[model samples]
Target: MLLEVIEAIRERVGKDYPVWCRLSAMEIGVEGGITLEETQVVAQLAEKASVDAIHVSAHLVGPGRRPPMAQPPGTFVPLAEGIKKVVSVPVIAVSRIPPELGESVLQEGKADFIAIGRGLLADPHMLEKVTSGREEDVAPCICCMTCLDSVTWRDEGIWCVVNAALGREREYELKSAEKPKKVIVVGGGPGGMEAARVASLRGHKVILFDDGDELGGQLLVASKPPFKETIDTFRQYMVGQVAKLGVELRLGERFTVDLLDELKPDAVVLATGVIPFVPQIPGIEGKQVLLVSEVLFGAETGERVVVIGGELVGCETAVYLLQQGKSVTIMMRGPELATNVNPLVRVPLIGRLKTKGASILTGVQYEEITEAGVTVRTETGERRTVEADTVVLAAGARPNTDLLTSVEGKVAQGLPVGDCVKPRGIREAVEEGYRAGLTL
Candidate 1:
């Protein structure tokens, strides 16, 4: 049937225009699924049918079906190489092929061409940046899969965490501000950085303040886990952008009323982010208990670690601890693990935890934290203690409204963006930050 369709299209086009056949080189995580050798045979057949090129791709089907966005760059290049060996026609390799990897793929004769999909969505000027030798300016796709997840799960339009101007190029176009203001942005998280970047681009004099010595707020912790280092790329891009745009960076200094009075800016953007929510469980204040940030930030952990909260943060933290060769368990009051995580990310993340021997307990009530471990009542109404030497709290966060309430009515134009308004993921933070900058 595929050959028939190819023939029909070729006959109609009279071989004048290029027509490429995209083949799933491998069906990952599926029993009896398509294999590379089979795909090579398919590619040869397609070439006989006069297909101009064979595009090597992959599919994660059955229960493992997910957006290939999470896969490493050039994930399918080997498949393309396999098919190229058998076919005379060019083979196009895809699946998260960034420019640098694509160039190496070509040099190594892995593929004749590299097809970039989501990377283009994140930064439409990707090729332009590469051509102009300004590749560092390209906004990177962090593989959050928010673009695919929005359409697949929510039936909504596409959204990119790194590129808020996506699908709204005209509306988000940065025009020189008719009246540029002195903008004071508080917090150095994604939101705060974004606010400063946009405002500076609009010709505003922007000064960004953060208590931490470094620029990244939660990203410093978010990027610590394995397979999540891509987040740091986006963070670095933002930091570089703000620096390049000449946004004043006042790190290691909190945004207080004293600073506000001293700067006396025309507008204030509060991207103060969030603080860890400490639950009322007894002994949570004990020295054995640590926040999620503490663990991710290199705090010493015991041989046995119990992480409270089974959401994305908790699960990822558990994975981090498991990688550290620690016995780890994740406990949550809810009935599900990684319920707040995107399905594409949750599947592999949960699998990693289980594969690494993580004990996941859900539908439980936290009774208390003790020197031994966390005591909880399971769904079956049984009391038990999950033995652990350390208790890490991944129980979510509350909006850091400290600066928000303090600056209310003090500034003529004050806006609270990102987690200061509500504690959510990167998408909300970045989008809100961009909007707040536009609002100002």
Candidate 2:
């Protein structure tokens, strides 16, 4: 049937237009999956059918398998190289192949062409920026999996976390402001930096402030975990953008009412982020208790660790600890683990935790925290003690609205963006930040 269809299409097109055959190079997580050698045979057959090019791709065969979109750059290049050797046709390597890696793939003679799908969706000008030696200007795809998860699981249109002007291109088109205003954006997270970037691009005199000495509020700690360093790349890109655009940085400076009055800016955007919320329980303030950020930031942990909370932060922290050869037990009040995380990420994350010998418990009630470990009431109301040397808190966070409350009604245009509006992830932060800049 493959040969018949190819012949029919060739006859219809009069052999003038090119026809590319997309083939799966390998099937992951399947006992009897298509192997590279089998794909090589298929590639030979497809080439014999007079196909112009062979697009090499890969697929995950079962649940809990890692999504290709979240994999590292040039993940499928090896597959393309395998198929290329079997067929004389040009082989196209794809799946999260960033520009730099794609260039290296070609120079290594792995594939004749590189296809960038989600990368282009994140930034349409990626190629132009690379060719012009302005690679930093290109918005990056952080592999957050929000774009693919929205379509596959949520049945929604695509969205990019880093690039806010994705779907509504015309609506977000940056036009020079007829009258520029002085803008002061507080909190140097994704939202605040993005607001500064966009506002300055529109001819506004923008000044960004953060309490920390360096930028990238939560992102600095977020990137510390394994398989999440792409987020740090995004953080670097944002920092460079704000710097290049001439947005004045006031690091290690708190944006208090006095500072607001002193600066006297026309507008104020609060991207103040969030504060960690530790549940109330006996011995909650013990010396052994540490926040998830603290653990990811290199705080020493005991050999046996108990993680309280099974959401995205909690689950990822368990993975980080498990990788360190520490015994980990994840305890959550809710019935599910990583319920807030996107399925594309949550599936593989939970798999990694389980594979690394991390125990996960749900429907838990915190009774108390003792020196030995955590005391909890199980789903059946049975009191039990989980042994641990250190207790890591990963429950959740609440919006930090201290500055927003202080500067209420003081500035002419006041906008609270990102997690300060409500505790959410990078998507909400970047989108809200972009919109806040446009509003000002």
Candidate 3:
């Protein structure tokens, strides 16, 4: 199939464009499907078929199996080197190759070129910065997989936590204002801070306003999760950027449309963020039932807890609870747990959760919340009850669009950005904020 596909493509495109064959080295089963001998045979076959290059990768086809490329400690280089010996064509090797490790792989003659997918995501200009000798300025990828999470959980486009300017390059650009205007941004959150920074960079006098004590908005809640330090880092970067650009920041100030009218600025950006959706379930309003954010940021709960949603938020919260030495059981109406989460991040997380003895019951309809725990009717029509002292509602969130509507006709130019516009993850918030900033 590989050779025939390449031949068909070559016949159609006339071989002007380079055509490379990407093959996975490992498969399921103890012996492995494509051994070193099979890989050499495939490489030789592709070379004989007049292919431009051969990219060798280790692939896994089951749940909880980590991709060979993403395996820790540089285990993929030997396979690439073996494949390189058999084929005269250029060999490309990939697996989470850090820059230092990637350089070593090339220096040691393991492969002609090293491929970095998640690495480049951690820093989009990785190769450019490394080659140009500006390595310090290069933002390091924390490999938290938030970028992958955005694609999986939110069903949105890919984005980097460090590089806020990615994907919205066309929308956000540094342009000198022909006639500079005074801009008063109404929130110091991600979107508001970003707007101020971008507007200031574009030669506009900008004043950022936020009622909150800090500038992160919903990002404050995000910082509490495991492996989510980068979210806080990006938030700090945005705050520092605002100060560096000399944008006037007014913190802890309540913002209203009347204030905007008094200032009479050119534009107003609302990044008020979202409010947690509190469902009207029986026993849900009690003190025992806490929001996921509460558990993430605040005090610990009882020994046994039942999380009421199996989405990414619920799963992570469950993991956090498990880490705190609590036995957690997640009940969801959905078909699977954390189905929206990115495959790259989810594989490892699920493995960890299973090892920690986390229980997941999917496709179960919520009947009510009781003092004992949650009562649910399973997909099989069985009445089941899961007991816990505390019940966490991680179902989802709703947009805080009330402010957006309130300031609709009050401001000359009204722009809605961040989770307030639509409840989403950090990547979407940053991208939305960055684009809003560029537009100003």
Candidate 4:
């Protein structure tokens, strides 16, 4: 598979484009996989193929496999050394290589260059900081994998928890704008707040409006989970940015087209977010059914809980409930679990869930929510019931596009963003909002 991929790349980009093959040195305990010797052989083959570099690291996938990030940097040094011996071209060593370790690898001739993925994300200009003798400015990655989690919960793409502006380069700016205009942003959520901040920074008169008292849309609910306080940092930073940029903020004011007409700004950005999907399952309304958002942001639940849907949100909510000492059984109508989740976070999370004894049932349609638990029908003509005290529905969400539809073509310069445009993560929301703000 690796050779095929490399060959295809070579075919398209030509031999001089510097195609490097990155692979795992060893799977640790896994059998019948690439060993250190095999890795060196592969590196030799790549060198023969005129590959630019051979990047080696430890990789582990599938259930019961500990990720490379979980292991120490020393564990991969031997593998790097082994590959370096055979490969004539530059060899790249990866897996949590700190500056000290990177320096040692370079000094000992184990590898030509140290490749740091998350490390660079933790500080995009890390090399600049290091070269200028200002290593203190380089933000160190905690390796907590919250950045991985953000891809799942916040949909903000890959980002370091410590570095607020990692994936937001396209959204946040420090330079002055060539053409700035007055902008009115509705909703103080991630999208709205971001739009206001970007517009104001670009020398535009900006006003951010939100019916809610505080900023942060669905992010507020996401921050409630354990070890997810880093999400709040983004919200706080966005709010602070708006204030620092002198973007006018109006809280607890409902947005209307009439109000927008009154403001008569240069542009209007709508980021109203989304509404929870209320399923019409039998006895669903009678039971204490709460949206995943409610359960995530609200109080604790009963000892036994049944989560409807097994997507990323449902899986995370189930994990959160299990962490709170509640018995969680997730019911999904699909064959797979957490399909929407990022592999980096999902792999580890599913492993942890297995250790914690959480139950997941897929390929089963939710029939109803009874007094005892949830009744589900399997695809194989089997009826199974799971006991639960609290039933949390995380089926999905509906875009709150009513306002967008109502105001469509009504305003001279109208733009729909965030969940109102489509129910997605903060990354899409902020990106769309930033684009809308820039257009203004």
- Tens digits of per-residue lDDT for model 2 on 323-406? 899999999988999888887787788888888899988999999999989999999999999999999999899999988877
Between 1 and 4, whose lDDT is larger? 1
Tens-digit lDDT string for candidate 4 (65-86): 5433455655677788888888
- Could you tell me which 10 consecutive residues in candidate 3 have the lowest summed lDDT? 62-71
Please list all clashing residue pairs in model 1, or write none if there are none. none
Cα misplacement distance, residue 31 of candidate 2 (Å): 1.5
| Residue 191 local lDDT, model 3 | 70
The collision pairs in model 4 are: none
Tell me the deviation in Å of residue 230 in model 4. Answer: 3.7
Number of the candidate with higher TM-score, 2 or 4: 2
Give the TM-score comparing model 1 with the true structure, all chains together.
0.96
- The C-alpha RMSD in Å for every predicted model, in order, reads 1.8, 1.6, 4.9, 7.1
For model 3 the local lDDT of residue 436 reads 73
Cα lDDT of model 1 by residue, 1-440, tens digit: 99999999998998789999899999888899999999878899999999999998888754334333446677678889999999998989988888999999999998999998889999999999999999889999998888888879977678899999898888888788899999999999999999999898889999999999999899889999877888999999999999999999999987788777889999999999898999999999999999999999999999999999988899988988999999999999999998877788888787788888999899999999999999999999999999999999999999989878888888889989898899998888888889888877
Worst 10 residues of 2 by lDDT: 61-70
User: 1-440, model 3: which lDDT tens digit per residue?
Assistant: 98898889889878677888887765643344667778789889988887988888875555555432235645667788989998988999887676788888899999998888776766677788789886654555656666666677766676776557665565555678887877777777667776777778889898888888888776677667666665676677677778888888889998777787678888788887777887777778878899998898876688889998888788878878898899899888889877876677777678767878999899998888888888889989999888888999898999877778878787667778877888776656666766776766
